[model samples]
Target: MTEIVRARGLVKRFDGLLAVDGIDFSIREGECFGLLGPNGAGKTSTIRMITCVSPVTAGQLRVNGMDVTTDRRRIKATLGVVPQDENLDPDLSVAQNLAVYARYFDIPAAVARARSDEILELFQLTEKRDETVDNLSGGMKRRLIVARALINEPKILVLDEPTTGLDPQARHLVWRKLRKLREQGITTLLTTHYMEEAAHLCDRLVVMHLGHILAEGSPQDLIERHVGGQVLELRIESDGDHADALAALRDRADLRLEDVDEAVYAYSTDQNWDPVMRDVASFGKAARLRESTLEDVFLQLTGRGLDE
Candidate 1:
């Protein structure tokens, strides 16, 4: 695979606090790679260092084969970044924001105008092209930010929490756009707390926790390796005495179990739903079983929900 982004022992520190401890990873060209972690996991700090907005305190970092320290300007020109926050110029009209950013790349007026026009239409922002940025809705502004990132026709795209606050429809729309970009072979590196988003968009990902690498692989590979392919969630109400039954079932299946407030989770790769159902049923109607999801694996591994 072609290497687009590479980092070795990357580290960052602020006020003597190690925000991003030594971590190493790489991104292949034309692939959508993910950085999955909860808040304060150093994902953002790593991005800032790789993007050259902040200096790395230790180790080597490269983007598009250029050294971040010596080739900062050149690397910046070849990359596009969309921060988690919307940093749009509120005073400018929607189209003008892209126009201005295009100019930052030293793109000529006529060409920049054409590119802006094409992207506005591409993002379905043509209808709002004349509206002030502050007047646009959150989703619209987000689409605009993505459109602006493409103004440079970058070789790699970096998105931090791209769909954090979007409604379902808007989130799906963004996913469609990203899929199109993947089809066009633009390498993308994304950081998000949403497990579903990572599973849907990332071909491979690295899970980070407390500035350390926990696991790395394709979403399906991680699930099959770290988390089983199938899971059975059971909620039982046994008048405050549920440990014995839960422990018996957990050992019988030889599965990992998680004890939440009112339920115990069982996970296994085997495709025998009947056994899982029967096991729960043996505990009486107090047990309820349901299929597992990516959300379950994330919580199981991280000990915290994605939204938390």
Candidate 2:
């Protein structure tokens, strides 16, 4: 696979504070790559620099073999962007919205109309073509935003929190469309707060926190490497005796333990969970265990604390 985007020591700063503190990564063509982190993790800042909407404070970034510094316009031209918020003109009709956004890319009127009709049908929004933005459902509006981005026929599609506000069914629908785009060989770079979104869409991803990459790999690879195959969470009651319970398994070198308030999370790799179950049995009915997930790896690396 070809490298579509490359960064080395990529840095972004604002008023002397470093937002993206020198990160390095590469994205492959025709694959979905994700940048995931909690708030204030520089995911958005990095995206801004990649799109050339913000200047790089230091280091090098290249998009499609073109330097971001010298080829800002060229890079922008090859990229399609879907922002986190709905920025569509509410007064415009569905078709009107795509036509107006297409103009920004300097797409000709005839070409824009043809593209809009085709994209609308592709997204199952053809029936709502002439409807005003206010009348469209939340799902329709989001699909429209994506359709507008495609008006330029970009090689790379950048989506920020694509399904943030949608319900389960709507989110699933968007995921299916994105998967179809990937099948068509479009490179996708995604920044999302939802862990499941990243897991489902990305072939690979980097977990970032405080402007640095904590880990990078496929979602399953990450889960296996960081948190192991299974997690045994032993929840203790608020007034329960945790010290005595922890002492039962303290000598076991295989368990990675985290004490979050009254909750005790024991991440283990031993697929044979009988040993861990015995300890949980010691804690009576206050304990339970289940399979670990990508979110577990994220929280393990980035922490459970809320950022602002």
Candidate 3:
């Protein structure tokens, strides 16, 4: 697949503060590429530069072979952007919102109407076409925002925290639609802090922290590389037995431990967990063994939770 977006030594600054500090990454055509990190991790800053919303303070940024610095107009024309904030017109009906946004791209009125109907159906918002934005539920509003972004039939879809603040059912609905879009060959660039969202939707991703890339690979690859195959989470108590449990885990060369607030996480590639489990059985209230996930990889690489 050809690279649709690329950056090298990219930097962003607001006065003296450095947001994105000399980073490099690329997005291939028709793949869902994600920038995963916590708040202020430069995910938003990097995407802003790619979408031409913010100026790059230094380094090279390109979209579809066009330079971001000199080709802002051409670049913006081929991009569909869903910002973090809800910018839908509250007074406009659902159908009207799409129609009006289409004008910005110079889409013909008749063609815009046709595309609006098609996209509304794609997002399952056909029944809410004539309803005002203010009348829709949070999920409906979110779907509409995404629907509006497609009014231009863009080549690359750029979403910044598209599922933020949505309930589980609503968020899942959005996820389903995005998956459908990817199946139809729309290259997507997504920035999100939600581990599950990134794991579920991204074909490949780069973990960003404090303006730099920590690791890049498929979700499963990162999990295997960072935290291994299985995780054993043991609740930690202040009792003397807990110290014994920690000491026992440290004695084993195969196990890696991370001590969080109330839990001691044991990571290992060994499938035989019997010996490890017995050592921590009496040390805490509970113990759970499960498959390692993207969250575990992020915590291992960053030494903090996603929200932190």
Best by TM-score: 2
Per-residue lDDT tens digits of candidate 2, residues 130-166?
Answer: 9999999999899999988899999999998899999
The C-alpha local distance difference test score for the whole of candidate 3 amounts to 0.90
* Candidate 3 lDDT tens digits, 1-308: 89999999999999797889899998999999999987888999998999998999999998999999999989999999999999999999999999999999999999999999999999999999999999999999999999998899899999999999999999999999999999999999999979999999999999998898999999988888888878998776656646665787888888888877777788986457998878766654578888999999887877675545
> Among all windows of ten consecutive residues in candidate 1, which has the lowest summed lDDT?
285-294
lDDT score, candidate 2: 0.90
Q: Give residue 266's lDDT in candidate 1 (0 to 100).
A: 74
- Go through the candidates in order and give the clash count of each: 0, 0, 0
Task: State which candidate, 2 or 3, has the greater TM-score.
Answer: 2
lDDT by residue for model 1 over 216-297, one digit each (tens)? 8888887877657777666667644467557556656557777777777777665566766775676675565554556666
Q: Clash pairs of candidate 2?
A: none
In model 2, the worst 10-residue window by lDDT is: 236-245
Order of quality (TM-score): 2, 3, 1
Question: Lowest summed-lDDT stretch of 10 residues in model 3?
Answer: 236-245
The C-alpha RMSD in Å for every predicted model, in order, reads: 2.1, 1.4, 1.7
Predictions in order: lDDT: 0.85, 0.90, 0.90
Off by over 4 Å in 1: 238-241, 269-276, 283-291, 305-308
Regarding TM-score, does 1 or 3 come out ahead?
A: 3
